[model samples]
Target: MGVRPPQNDDDEPDTITFGIAALDAHLERADVEFPVDAETLLTQLGDPDIPYDATGSTVALSEAMDKVHIQHFDSEQELLNTLHPVFESYRERAGNSILGQLRALLPF
Candidate 1:
């Protein structure tokens, strides 16, 4: 078990704590650094960031983002299930993402 992670809870299939304090500090720093995904979508919709004009009414960009927020967690479980195999297929794809980069830089 050289370089193996210690078990934290038997209930969990895996436990890989890089350590609470270090992981928390890294997470906080990463939070501020990651870009919001929808910003690009909004920008592409229009310059001056035109609000989302639905079937009959105009909705502000903030309102659109809010609407998206509500829908996000609603599909979390379903999305997780759907994406599980995709994630499993490209285990290293995550390594190319921001979190992966941060993980690579961790001293642990």
Candidate 2:
């Protein structure tokens, strides 16, 4: 085997990190410059799969970007701040999905 992600004691299958945590991959890309326009950011990011909630399900970065009203971001911080609530809305919606309701029945 090659390198592995650090494991959690709870033994979850995926290390589901959301919000700014999920943007690590996008932010690290050299092609993405700050003060970027929303459309350009979406295109450059290539619509990454961002972990949306505790269930480890995901929504595309493009999906979140679509709901963002801001035309441009002066810095990564601005982008993150704007998307934070957008991600939360997706999380809330996902939590209300049938599968999420089914998961709620689980004792774990």
Candidate 3:
């Protein structure tokens, strides 16, 4: 985890870096294998509206998941347990992204 100094009072005091290490640690604890690369998955989770331009990837959610071969989870609890940390880390940075919006709706 990393902290970014706020540029202004409105800015968040801390910024979480949702990079490979964090993802790997979470996955290791969850005991699950995600076929997608951490960076790619994080990018998608962070900004669904932004096109994944590295390899001309589209912005469509289904297309992106398909490209990464993200299939079913071992169980719903496992999925939530694995993703909750990532979501928490990204809460401030997410802004209007899908995860951010969902976070607003869900107490968890």
Model 1, 15-104: lDDT tens per residue? 332212222333354442323244543343331221111111123333334433332222323423433343333334555678667766
- Every model's TM-score: 0.22, 0.73, 0.23
**Model 3 error, position 66 (Å):** 12
Question: Of the pair 1 and 2, which is ahead by lDDT?
Answer: 2
Error of 3 at 70 (Å): 8.6
Q: Which candidate should be chosen as best, given TM-score against the real structure?
A: 2
Between candidates 2 and 3, which one is better according to TM-score? 2
Model 2 Cα lDDT, one tens digit per residue, 17-93: 67667775567874678889988887888878888666667788877787877889999889888988888888788
Worst 10 residues of 2 by lDDT: 1-10
lDDT leader: 2
lDDT of 2 at 42: 75
